[model samples]
Target: MGKGKNKTHEPKNERQQRGANGHSARQNHKHMEMKYDKSEKMKFPVKLAMWDFDHCDPKRCSGKKLERLGLIKSLRVGQKFQGVVVSPNGQGVVCPNDLEIVEQHGASVVECSWARLEEVPFNKIGGKYERLLPYLVAANQVNYGRPWRLNCVEALAACFAIVGKMDWASELLSHFSWGLGFLDLNKELLEIYQRCTDADSVKKAEKEWLEKLEMETQERKSHTKKTDIWMMGNINRRGNGVQSDELESGEDSEQSGLENSEQPIEYDALGNAIHVDSVKSRIMLSGVSEDEESDFEENEKPVNYDSLGNLI
Candidate 1:
């Protein structure tokens, strides 16, 4: 017997072929036809929102769908939690996609048109922990192939991916026509980015990925993004917590009754908009009511929860 090797030798070409096949298989995994689990229903931990500045089509918007599914529960601006505000304008590269970040701070996404970002009512809502999601391509009907034009749920799903929670993200997006396509586009980069902890690290990974995917990206004037110019806490002419085209069509104008008055919107330290007049039964300080006890009683005991905002 030959003073032998412990195992039979594979031909070099065969070994290389096997390695290539394995890699190809893995790459293909990201592109596999996305399957939806019909029975899969989940309540993701992060709070999602859309400022609804553009007055997104009620019929087609993914955020509205998420809200209907109860996956995106509405929380009043005054209600308390450590939250991350996703802004395309944020100078900080850090985002809420990391597990520690999500566990420590809940995530929120604002939906505004990338083209006319000036229209979003930034001053209406309060935000402290600002975050900027790195460049990612759009996969929706209106702005397909465009980067940074994500719908609300898709943006939140990316945050979910950053925190390494893919299942919940996928489930929310499964209802959209191009939902799976987003995950496919960002899987590898997200896997890389989620490992980063801070803003600088996240930005580093983002820069690398952007360079790699440089060809697929489209460039527009930086002016299109008003992330730097807008100031928070400066309520616009609308004066309420929102300003949209819907409002211009005389929706909230009558209810606000402030078309002539020039008083600035008053906000508490926590950023709650304080109306001079008692809010009507239809409008509430808390979430919209489907029940009769519509008044938001300040004396109602707050739910006792741990520091993590988890029920004790």
Candidate 2:
């Protein structure tokens, strides 16, 4: 009995040892797999072309060509791209893998994605002046040698205005022109200045547009009034509230009286002349005195007016 018990305990201990070893091995394997996955996700640098499209006519190329040139791509959200990576002295760009890309080609790293470039329409790409204008303005201040920046600044201002970003357009004008002159005195900058000045002109033009809108509104109101009059006439004819025949009869009677007599005759809907034979008799019947009436009229006069002439 003792030998059988010992044999059973020895086998049980071996099984427990095996189970523990298997569990540890599985845990180790999982940890290694997680580390490997993390490393694989990290981006390594690669060499890419930096093309200049500042003067390139986009009209001459297909969409595919634009993509190849890296001109069309914009930055993707949460994606790392390239930039100039400027140092204290403003000179850098050692490893291609070390760099990230940005929208502007001027940056050191390839900063945009093929997706962003392809997503935006070709026509709209050049019209994104608001996005590019501030950089141009800043670059102009840093390096005036680049005459193209001026043109870019102007284009951006105009683009902003066209897109209904008047505040931005105004800001660009105020910053570049320094408040006094429209033209940048730099001869090289003139080309760009001419293009951008239109943004300010656009704001002024909005006033004329508003005046046109007002005129249109007035014309619409007049048309609506005429329609209302016709509707009212029809309503009267249909006897909705009053009869048109009665109104017409009254007008006819007044015209006949005017032709026959020198005195003017005003008739009610029943065609009876509204003749006030005695104004004093009516006032007396109402128990109102002339002096009280005069006092009331004087009190009702507007005090703010210089005189009756001023009221008119």
- RMSD (Cα, Å) for all candidates, in order, is 24.7, 26.7
Clash counts for all predictions: 3, 13
Q: Per-residue alpha-carbon lDDT of model 1 for 1-312, expressed as tens digits?
A: 111011024444433233211333234223121111111235455545434332455567665565556555333223323566666755575453355656566566654446666655455543666667777777878778888777777777787777677886797789787899999987777788778877778888888877866644432223222221121122243234655344344455422443244533333222333343444422343223424223334545323232222343
Q: Give all candidates' CA lDDT scores.
A: 0.52, 0.31
TM-score of each candidate structure, all chains considered together = 0.50, 0.21
Model 2 C-alpha RMSD to native? 26.7
lDDT against true structure, model 1: 0.52
- Candidate 2 per-residue lDDT, tens place, 87-119, comes to 111222112221122223222112222223443
**Candidate 1 TM-score over all chains jointly:** 0.50
Which stretches of candidate 2 lie above 4 Å from their native place?
1-72, 77-196, 233-312
Off by over 4 Å in 1: 1-42, 75-81, 94-98, 215-312
Model 2 — TM-score against the truth? Answer: 0.21
